[model samples]
Target chain A: MPEIMVFAATGRTTEQKRGLARDLTDAMVKNFGVPAESVTVQIIESPRDSKAKGGILFCDR
Target chain B: MPEIMVFAATGRTTEQKRGLARDLTDAMVKNFGVPAESVTVQIIESPRDSKAKGGILFCDR
Candidate 1:
């Protein structure tokens, strides 16, 4: 199963998220040659404070 | 760079999320010999309706 998981800070509209999922699914189906139904795309959004980079929280960045 | 991404439906408490992140970081550090700071854990939470399995939305399940 090809499952695509997207991680990012929260802010995207539902439409944007839907488009992203669709696009990603399309990519996987085209490249991996998997059925669209077998491809699962999940967008995981976190609050700024929950994620960090280079030892600094995203909220602090 | 070892980045850990967790995908799950929303509902976890802040403390649980924090603990999960910490534990995952520890695991990566222990197994991969990566520095604690080098390990990034991001929990991506999706609304129930946004995620689906087996052609059915999680909210509907």
Candidate 2:
């Protein structure tokens, strides 16, 4: 199974997440010949405080 | 920067997650020569209900 994981700051609508899942599945099927049923998309919502960029926490930026 | 994402069932202990983050970062540093500081490990916890296996939702398993 192809487990696709995406991470971003929290707060996407359910529709966006669903669309992403579907898109990822389609891409896997297209490129890797993986069946749609075997592809999994997991979206990780990271709190700003827990993520940093360029020496600054996302929460502080 | 290497953005490594891992997808697994919810309920890993904090220690396990941290260890995974460090291990992933180390691997990236060793193989890709990316600085450990530039590596990001995002752990995605999928709810059993939202994830399916063999056309069946994990919640039922």
Candidate 3:
């Protein structure tokens, strides 16, 4: 099974997330020739405070 | 460099996430003997409705 995990800021609509999941699965299936069901996608949402970039926290931006 | 991503339901404190990141990085450093700074940890949160298992959505359960 091919597992893909994405991390983004919180607050996306369900439709958007599902669309992304399907799209991601499609990519893997078409490229790697894996079955759709064999692909697993997990979109993880992180708060601004939890993520930092270049020594600065996202929440501070 | 190694990247470890985790997906879970939302509502964890920043402290918890940071602790997890540190711990995960530590594990990679000890096991793989990679530099601590080379490990990337991203904690992603998903809504229950966004995840499905065996054709049954998490929100429906």
Candidate 4:
């Protein structure tokens, strides 16, 4: 089984994540021969201030 | 080829993302029998306010 983890800032809806998971899993199965059911995709949503670059947070960027 | 997309909140360092990519790729190879070079992992950092749920953003979580 192939496991995939995706982290997104907390603003997208659950439906979006599900869509992404579905599309990504489908792509992996079709292209890489990985079984559709064997692919695991997870989305981790974080806060804007939880991430920063050059002293600026993602919200600032 | 298996294309994997990882979205981070932008707080993680490049090294961290690289490490994650390396580990994820290695796991895929060792357990899922995927070619190391053929597994593509990408990290996308989004703004906290770019996503929302229940009328609130991820940063507020």
lDDT of 4 by residue, A1-61 (tens): 3456754456756665566666666655554455688677876667887755468887899
What is each candidate's DockQ, to 2 decimals?
0.25, 0.18, 0.19, 0.07
Q: What's model 2's overall lDDT?
A: 0.72
Highest-scoring model, lDDT: 1
Kindly list the per-residue Cα lDDT of model 4 for residues B1-61, writing each as its tens digit.
3445754344555665666566656644554444787677876677776645467876896
Model 4 residue B49 distance off true place after TM-score fit, in angstroms: 42
- Report the CAPRI category for model 3: incorrect
Instruction: Highest DockQ: give the candidate number.
Output: 1
Lowest lDDT block of 10, candidate 1 chain B: B13-22
CAPRI accuracy category, model 1: acceptable
Per-residue lDDT of candidate 1, residues A1-61 (tens digit): 8888788888899999889989999999999999999998887678965675443456665
Estimated TM-score per prediction?
A: 0.58, 0.55, 0.55, 0.49
Better of 1 and 4 by lDDT: 1
Q: For candidate 3, what is the DockQ?
A: 0.19
Clash tally, candidates in order: 0, 0, 3, 6
Look at candidate 3 and tell me the lDDT of residue B52: 42
Clashing pairs in 4: A7-B7, A11-B51, A11-B52, A12-B51, A12-B52, A51-B11
The parts of candidate 3 lying over 4 Å away from their true place are B1-45, B52-61
Model 2 chain A: weakest 10-residue lDDT segment is: A13-22
